[model samples]
Target: MTMSFSPQVLLSKVARERCIANIKELPKFALNDEGSKKTYASVLVPLCVVKEEVCLLYTLRSSNLKNHSGQVSFPGGKIDEGETEIDAVLRETHEEIGFNARDVEIWEKMPIIQGRNKEMIIHPIVGVLNNMNVDNLVRSVDEVEDIFTVPMKELCNIENHGHLKLQREKIILPVYTFGKYTIWGITGMITHLFLQCFLPESLYTNDFMRKKYTIGELMPSKI
Candidate 1:
């Protein structure tokens, strides 16, 4: 049977009653500041219609970079001094992939995500893109190595997802592979949380949420 995954349906189902207010305060672990001072960052989770299916856009980072080099991630970077989270994400998106603020419709701000090392706090802002073609993008050669999208249906496929056991902690973390790119760590956690918004409970059961991760429900856009 064919599945319906239209933008309108997704917007209605994920954004109708959910909002940032539903999320509780940041946990104690996320608030730890005993070590290196935490840095602030933001990312844009872009949803667009591609080839008649809803897909999420991602970028392959240049391998020469100092941090998170050669990994697939959303378009974002550190929030600049005196800049709001939304401003930083939009600016980073433009700088990284030539995706201008005018080309995206701001939707909701997901919960703040703290990096595993406790050195960074990332704010994920969800938005819908006006364009879907990768050829249309003018990526920053110094930052982005490539651009791609994975259909939402593929992400929801249980067969396409798996777990990687952490040797040090003996804990398992979710991992997802799309084409040649493997998404794990902070990106993987964000993806898992985002999928929970619209995916069925039966499809995302134990495997996806074996370890609890904090993320706010989808909120309506004021933009």
Candidate 2:
């Protein structure tokens, strides 16, 4: 029962249905804006699901690396000069994860994520690995320290994890405590957005509603 839907189709459907849902009163966004200010184009978050369940693929970046070192991230990098959003995402995925782009079935891209006036538009691309198993992946030693998969159900489940008010922000975010790593910041924001998009309306419960959805959901795309 592996569920598959065009990314565009799912995003459109979610927007139409949840357009009126009030923003969660969270202070995380304000903190993110104030703490670090950098504009980057296009981020690729890989959504891998198999056997009727969805899982998120993450990488622990090498600690010695510059920028977001030792943080949990998807297989993505900055958009190159003159590169399309899709090109950057696909290219970065190949370079970081060592996976052939041909094996990934990109379903839809989440709306363009805008920050405070930098013209660096971020896009969330959703794709499934042809076979959603660890056996199919090859993590790059240079960029990725380790590659791991967390079941989408665990992420969607409130009992599995909890949120925190970081930097005294009013908002609470889903912080997946994987070992000693806490997935936060933009990656956390993006993860929250996707859960809201894919979880069925009935299945969405308390914590689902408590967490503030990404502002990216409201941001308009150039297309």
Among the numbered candidates, top TM-score falls to 1
lDDT of 2 by residue, 44-78 (tens): 67766544455678888876677657777778877
Q: What number of clashing residue pairs does each candidate have, in the order they appear?
A: 0, 6
lDDT for each candidate structure: 0.72, 0.61
Candidate with the greatest lDDT versus the true structure: 1
In model 1, how large is the Cα lDDT of residue 31? 60
- The 10 consecutive residues of candidate 1 with the worst lDDT sum are 214-223
Per-residue lDDT tens digits of candidate 1, residues 60-161?
888778887777789999999999999999999989998778888877788788786768899988888886566788899999888889887788776567
In candidate 2 the C-alpha lDDT for residue 33 amounts to: 51
Task: Provide C-alpha RMSD values for all models, in order.
Answer: 7.7, 9.1
How much is 138 displaced in model 1, in angstroms?
A: 1.1
TM-score list, all predictions = 0.81, 0.68
After superposition, candidate 2 runs with Cα above 4 Å error: 1-39, 50-52, 114-121, 166-171, 179-181, 206-223
